[model samples]
Target: MENTMTKSILKNKCLIIDGTRAFMMVWLGQMISFIGSGLTSFALGVWVFQKTGDITQYALISMFFILPGVLLGPLAGTLVDRWDRRTTMFISDLGTGLSTLSIAVVYLLGGLQVWYIYVAVFLSGAFGSLRMPSMQAAMTMMIPKKSLGRTSGLMEIVQIGQFLIAPIVAGGLMESIGLAGIVMIDFSTFLIAISILLFIHIPRATVTAEGCAGQGTVLQEAVYGWKYIKARPGLAALMVLFAFTNFTTEMTVVLFTPLILSFASTAKLGLAMSLCSSGFLVGGLLMSIWGGPKRRVPLMMILMILLGVFSTMIGLRASVGLIVVSGFLATLTVPIISSSNQVIWQKKVAVDVQGRVFAIRRTITLATPLVTYAIAGPLSDLVFEPLMTVNGALAGSFGQVLGMGPGRGIGLLFVCMGLLTTLVTAIGCLSPRLRKVEEELPDAVITQSAQVKIEKKLPSLLPARSPRNKIVYAKCHDLKPPLPELLSRD
Candidate 1:
């Protein structure tokens, strides 16, 4: 009996470790594909700006990238839950690749038009939306509960690598091999990602009462994610805060390229962007090593406030050096903020319902950015740009302080965005519900011991549903009432 028990424990440990291995495998393929897509994206941004010489048209690309994701997120999330996550990711990658290939073909044959690029971007975004929730849900299945923060940080590294490397390389490649070659490379990356998915297996989430409650017709299931969030005031408030921050971030993103290109050459723009984006890599590495602080809310809020301060610095001067330094500082806070927030949701929400819940969370937060992208260009070109010119209205006051010129108006806008972001973050920090959310919410993640017990057929030791119909998993860290006392109550 002793030997049998030991064997059971060993088997469970192997299964848990295998899940981590699977996660790394999937992550590798995605990382490669991310770099490839970044190349195409950077090349296209340069191409569009050069072609039209219009910030409004350049901003349209970002708007299209976000619009479909915000619009279709709920439906995509429901579908992710209903379907196999691995398969959904597979299809999503394939569809996005096809869209990219279409752009390459159009460019080669009939000569690519601006409208063609927009159509391709729209189709790509529509397909890419399905990948986000599915990937997050898959991560929950593959990663241990305690390691979610580190893993999220690791994921950020992929994003950082894409941004840090792609711009510098794409700028050079565009002059040599050209955009067509870049697009084909991106399509090949999709194939590599799908091939990896074909080999690896992602575990299905265990059905809980929360997951069951969310099960219904398509429309009903889609709406249930919103209801789930509404019931948790902390999560709802967190999402609202994210929406506001995302708005400010998008406003900056739409303007950054134009801001740099205004007073500098394309080569300098690439160099400045590459230098700034390196901060993302550094932050990701730090988070991966340290796994963030224990009190995540305070850390997140503090970083957000710092992010605002950095944004203000970006537009204080027209120098590339200033923009590089400020941009780097601003991006440094992003991965830390994102990883902490992601870990909170991972810990609090049940795995089975994560797809729908994460989907809705994404939709709400991203909705703000859609509006930001749509209006940022016109606002910069028409309103802000005109106000800070040499003979413009605000030239005597605000322009004197910020310096009057082509990009100075946009610089003034950045100062306003930075101030607003800081103010909003400060207000969010004061919310007791948001601040003390960790104390209020019980951990929904299943423990390794719980998994072991379930596999060993110790039904009596398994978790039970709480009065609130929540699964009361035995978290090893909840020591106040003692593990046995908590389990007994459940």
Candidate 2:
């Protein structure tokens, strides 16, 4: 009995040691790069708000992140599936570096306009649209399922670490080197990421048995993602649900910044943003240690409830401390949501096809942020601002608390938005489908588990199979294709 216990402890330690290398290979470079990127992003956001002092201009920064992703997702997803994933990631890092260098040059040249910054941000989004999905897809291929929860939790910690530090760093850096220094930091980190990535080799992915997923025309491959998602009821539902959540969150944010700014200043904006990062940091830390509940859906629902409460709190009254605390609470649930979502994909999707499937998945998931960017500016600037004022529609009652003038009116609208988000969650939870996601969307078991679940049942498949089995075989990561498809494939 003692020997058995000792062996178990040693095995657990070995797993940790193995994971430490994986974390360095996968997570460390990303975390360092993200911190630098966060610094640049925060610096840009504050600079815009400080210079224009307009909420619309502030929201445009988000557009820079969203528009390109939505517009280019289809093609990007196809190409990502078609290319070598590690190379794709390296290229993405390099692309961002190039963009950063250009922005730095523009700053030095003193030709840095709102339009230039906007364009750079858009380009970064475009490149990022390619990079993020590839990285996500790679994780499933490389990491073991049992450890996925921990790995994703650690990655979130890294992300939150960046956010927690960025605002504080950006704020101080602004006083010292301005935008150029932030851009410079971003540029350097990308190089560091590229250097690390150069050493890791990811085997090229290709479909087998049924047909080559990569040999098709762009449109053919792109449509396949649509077909793939439609075939899986659970995956489609996750995408659509996340799209709504993303849209609402984006819209609320458009309203959120202005609401806070009215009650405070740009520096206060930095402080609030940093504090918001604290919620994510703390949440991530807890997740890395405790992990999540075995059932993911319930945990996600509870997190959504907290998000609604916090959103409403920020809008109801604009105390700086209250706003910062509320923002912190709003992000606190992120690690749970994100890590679980990653586990879902890693388990359900095949590593080979994950590149395309996840790409399309990410593309659609990104739509809300784009929609928010598109509409938030107009709605807050024009409609809500007008309706909630002293002499406007709700002036008699709401105007007393929200006030007659500019910022508070917008704040009131944001409060209403928070309620709407909460209502949506209530409705979503009541859905039989989302509630039963586990039963319906069972994890997409890998064809051959490298360990205990290794396939003892390697069923034989002829070159041309029964059509349905043929397609299934083609999609399997375990099925190595006939030579020509594997060799002439890329």
Candidate 3:
């Protein structure tokens, strides 16, 4: 028994050391790949807009990019679980690189069409759906559960790099090297990403009896993801919370560019974007070092409320200074909120099933953005903007506070969305299930041996109980009063 315990402790210590090194090595390569993909995205958006001079056409590109991922998410996740994670990521990167190369080839041949771009981007998105869930699930094995929050924080820094560096670099390169050159650079980055994955060893999730029982046809596995979440009420409620939050956030995102352009120049917009993304960079750095509060759910809720307040502040004025401050603060909250929430899911959900569960969660939450995108433009053009005009009805009442001018109506919409986000978060906090999620759901990765020892020791440490009051507990850490004792208190 002592030898077994000694081996377990030593094993855990080694994992603590090796896991950080392995995760960081892979993370560095993915960071390079993210920057490259961002450059391509920026360059392509510019190319499309310059070609057609229509905002709708440019927007369609984003729609095409996201639609495939959402539609194929469940099936892709099932495949992710079935395949080796490193191999899955390698294939995804290779396919996306090929797609990018094809675009460059088309452009070089003077045969590049809008349809060609759509098809290529859609293919890339489909592959991305496979890569992301695989990567996320693999991380659960690569990093210790205790470090998941910090690891997510590091991942957030990569996103900040993409957002902060890509556009500026892509804009400069477009003038000197042009579209083909930029795309070729992106392809090179993919090669780097693939090469790193080839050299690294990522441990796979241990398939339990429950996981095996659910495996069958691809369709059954895909459907199993939904059923799994349905069985876990806490996880289901969390997904719904994010879906509503994403819907409101997307409405703000779709309108943000136009809102700035209405009163500010492109140069000012660029500066504002840089400032905003820097907040993410700083927030990520802090979270990586500090981790977060021990009780992460409450921290996440507080950050969500802060985000809502910042979102409202963003639309309170047309002044560039206010927007810059608000945008920076709003973006700053994202990494912490995301990191906290990710850790909750990582610790609670079994890693073997994470690929499917996370994918379904992604699919459902992302669906709201599509709906929000579809409605945002029409709502702004026909309803909000018209209502905020100087001569319009609301101009005399609400418009006075928001100001009667261009983009002011959109400002009103921003305020409404922000308040909705805040209200939803507030209400969600009141739900006992959500508030007690960490207490109710057992940690899926707890060492079975350790749990057994705890269970054996627990009864001796507590008061004697009647036969009817005794309960078999799977999660020893969550020991609490008997059900009748709790019900009597209620």
Candidate 4:
């Protein structure tokens, strides 16, 4: 009786929802999960930092969180393409939720170690790899092309909860219900996200010439994402630009907490983080409504330059106010830039091939961050921290302006990295291929119909010249009804 009523309710709800409304259902669930996860993340970071007080060890948590996902991206993407996207997401959420539960169990048993958290984070990341590509590929089917920008913007609101609200709440909760309680909340959010998946419908991607060409053994299909991008110079160049920018971004992210903690209390750290990150919320809201400019490439470049400027400001002084204002402005640009970039990929890549292509893109861009996370700790601790000390070598020279203190070395490093980011963006703007990508690349045809209709007509529509190489005309254009039906007499 319960099962039947649940199904009835789902069917009744789904009946009124169009593609956009369906996406909203999914988005709301993800937003809740983000907030829940954010609370745990904030608590964990504080716990680890207070327990160890070593920057290198603190940095390892992030590395472990990211490395497994980056390494598994290609394989995960292939599976996402082969599986029902909703099912794939369901499994991903379950796996991550279990990982969270394991940490809680360990803590309850009084056997929880930092290393245990690392292992759990690694497992969570492996599961998360599937969730990322699955969500991206599913979006194309659930949203109209015109609304893609707004959808991306709306998605950034999840980050607002994760980055802004989570830190503040987590800080207060840490003194009350504690980390185990926080982890339990995260697990509950995952269940809620999984439940939402059962009530929504995502249309399967219709196979096209591009998708057919990509078909083969598992290895062949995984490699296909790379081949598709290489054939498109514009996308390749854009990937390179993102690779460098993401590197700087990660370096800043890894260092931001430690930098603040070096000179202030954990309470202050949480406040600065939450307040500065409000920029993401402001930016997300703006993008949700504005949907960005038509000429997205130029807008992305301009935002990148501004991001570099704000990043530099983050380390200018150890003052909380400076970091808060600068950090706010910096984060404000993130959603707009990310939304613009995502819209470009959605428009350029065929729907069926997006899983593989987006995975490959994420793998390449994310690989750079592994280097940043690995070196961010040792470099800051061994090199930058030493050089910025009051009586150190740099105190007589470079330290004169930036000041010589505990976190000053990181501040100087932030200045240099931010300047480099600006320089890199400026150089990237000179690449003609990247600047003219919109003009050179054709917007892919995305049909918003049930998969059965297109798949049923696919066999008769194939071209003969090269079965996989030639474009299927009917798939690219609207399919007309059969002539027999039009000519029949009653």
Candidate 5:
């Protein structure tokens, strides 16, 4: 029976959700929902900016949107594994949609305010925090190990694709249908996402020793992910890498537009963002078709270097077209880096443990964005911006060539950021620990007899005999002494 269950999982290549189908279905849902959500988010940013005319205050909305999820990371990941995957996704979509619908109601009632938007964004963040890990674990379980990298690439594409189109669409939608209309469309997308999840099936993960007889309470289960990470160096290193990358990107994001807009206009900003988005989309398409090479880490390292190069170029010239070209180049490297990371996690960890492990992974890594939110703006606006200007300290020596002005202030920030990114990747490559992480890590290979063999072998290894099979345990364990006397003494 154990063998049968294992074979069933491995053999299917069709039937709507035999792993491969599950990937496509989930991908489609994510693709639609992401674009719609991006549209609403951009529109909200514009609405708040127009109303308040304060960049800091407007930027505060993003904080309200993602912080709750970071706070709720552990709880969300644990509960996702306990609950049904489809139901988890459905509840997430439905709850988030309801939240969006409430904001639309405020607009209808003529009682909308900035505070209301903050509240809505916070609630949406909380729901979404749970939704992401559940989806990650589900897909990991659903896909075969060999195809993991391409799937990871495909996910990055879907994620970045919306960012590419959402702003442009939102900008246009704002002109025609207004903010309220845009949100209404967002609400509809949530409903659509829920419907798509309904048509698919995700296999239930086998309960583990951690969740079974030696079971943890909810809090312990939440920390199960942390415990998993502590045991694996590969995952730990990846977490650190993501933290820095997230923080650096956040800073670059702050400087990128200011530097570009100085040479070009705000319209040019949209074009640059679109070009970046295209790079990711093309990478995803490549990943989906070709998958990745057998060795995942090398690809990741190369992509990181590519990203660093493009990042430096953004700092080199204030030319709008040049910066926009760099943006395209910058985005091209993302899918490669992201897919490699995902493939590593999926291959190294057990499918059953992924919910807690990946969730904790997200908890640690995702929090870096908040760090970006905390540091990027201030560093650019205060230290970097001021120091590079004509009257600032560095002006006398190099500021003349570097230029000593408002935009040049941000140029200093970009150069420093590009150098930091390159150095981090270089250090990562130099470390034998990170470079051969796969060699040190466990690879989860699903052999043809995987399930039955593991099950049969486990009882022999355990001291106690289960009620269902004392005779079978005796045979499996090859008992040399009488078991009944030992059982009575125990």
Candidate 6:
């Protein structure tokens, strides 16, 4: 079975050259769409806050945006595998575009309400659930195995742009274009994305026996990803590590705005955010060029530890400079860590089931943010703030170190979350299963091929007079041992 699989893979490898061009076309369209989406998201948040003057209401907009994707991810991913990936992307973009268009029309008609925005956001999220996993799975097919890391880094560049450029542009545009105009721009980008995808072809995964077995129902197929992960202890451990890491990071994310605002003006907060976002841009560029460390697991763990350290530093001082520096350093690690982790998944998971597997991974990893966001506010107001107050119980010890006052409580919370993140990373690093994941998990895509020698007489099988071809084909005696045996020898 192994030999047969190896030979099959070798034959198909000739069909897939380095897919840099194809990947970039799709990536460029998606990046443009993401920036447009970000513009609308920032504009909407500002609009909602302006109208209601309630942080909770503003926060709920984000909640609505995430909830649908989180709830429907498994189903969406299953469908992504079942359907043509390019078609899935087209439908997702079209649906999201329509949702954004509805918001624009509603606003124009003066019938726009908070509930309507929520509904549109929910619909966009549902479509995104389908779009993201399908795109990821398609990437594995489009790019050569060796280039996945660099491809992930390039992908990060698109993501970083949303945080780095979108807000500033959106803030400026709101003064001239207004919310309706901003949403229309977002809709237009979606149309562009759909148009780009229409010209592309994304290959479908070849269903294996295991994949076919789970296709009895969508629910069964959805659960298949989890089962697949469960069977791989190393992969399961990696997921758990990321889940805890994501939770800690998200808790810090929840507190960052309030923490910065407690001491600095809104202008300074924006500057700090921009500076932090630049870190992602820088990190992504570096990863794209350098392709990260060869040993991805170790690099990921180290980056996590660095992230924890920088996160802790953000709360050590209330100064704007300190926050800026710490925030930048903390965010700088994000792209590298994310890309490194993605490379591991791309290498380990089979392309056929990556959609479902990545979907489950996304669902599990993102669940933490929802929980953290729900509790962060109450925890700060009721528990941490009081404890960090001047007259509170811990005032003499912890309060003296972290300081007491407006944002002090959130600062202390940052410290605790940072420590938790560091400890989790340390534990993950020490675990043998996680530490040796690369060795334990065989590469799903074979990079090396067996050397074959074909006689000049076999002109039909061997390309005649091809100097560009690097494959060395020998006489029949050299190839008779089976390709797998030759590959093993090499």
lDDT of 3 by residue, 1-490 (tens): 2223234434444332335676787788889988999999999999999999998889888888889878999998888887767667888888888988899999999999998999999998888788778878878877777788889899888777777899989989999999999999999999998767644556555444335556789999988889888888887878888889889877987888888998999999888888987889888988999888878888888889888999998888898899999989988898998878878887887766788888898899778988987899999999999999999879998888889889999999999999999999999998888888888987775443433444564463342121211222322233344222322352
**lDDT score for residue 297 of model 3:** 82
Model 5: per-residue Cα lDDT over 387-427, one tens digit each: 87778987875587667877777877777777788888888
- Tell me the deviation in Å of residue 87 in model 1: 1.7
Query: Each candidate's root-mean-square deviation in Å?
Result: 6.9, 8.8, 8.8, 6.1, 7.0, 7.4
What is the model-wide C-alpha lDDT for candidate 5? 0.73
Error of 4 at 475 (Å): 11
Using Cα atoms with residue i matched to residue i, what is each candidate's TM-score against the true structure?
0.86, 0.81, 0.87, 0.87, 0.87, 0.88
Q: Residue 284's C-alpha lDDT in candidate 2?
A: 80
Q: In candidate 2, what are the lDDT values of residues 195-218, reduced to their tens digit? A: 666444443432433225434798
Q: Candidate 2 — worst ten consecutive residues by lDDT sum?
A: 464-473
Model 2 clashing-pair count? 1
- Which residue pairs in model 4 clash with each other? none
Which is superior by lDDT, 3 or 4?
Answer: 4
Flag the better candidate by lDDT, 1 or 3. Answer: 1
Please report, as a residue range, the 10-residue window in candidate 6 with the lowest summed lDDT: 448-457
Cα deviation of 125, candidate 1, in Å? 1.4
Against the reference, the lDDT scores of all candidates come to 0.82, 0.69, 0.80, 0.82, 0.73, 0.81
* Residue 472 lDDT, candidate 2, scale 0-100: 26
Per-model tally of clashing residue pairs:
0, 1, 0, 0, 0, 6
CA lDDT, candidate 2, residue 385: 78
Q: What TM-score would you give candidate 3 relative to the actual structure? A: 0.87
Q: Which has the higher TM-score value, candidate number 3 or candidate number 4? A: 3
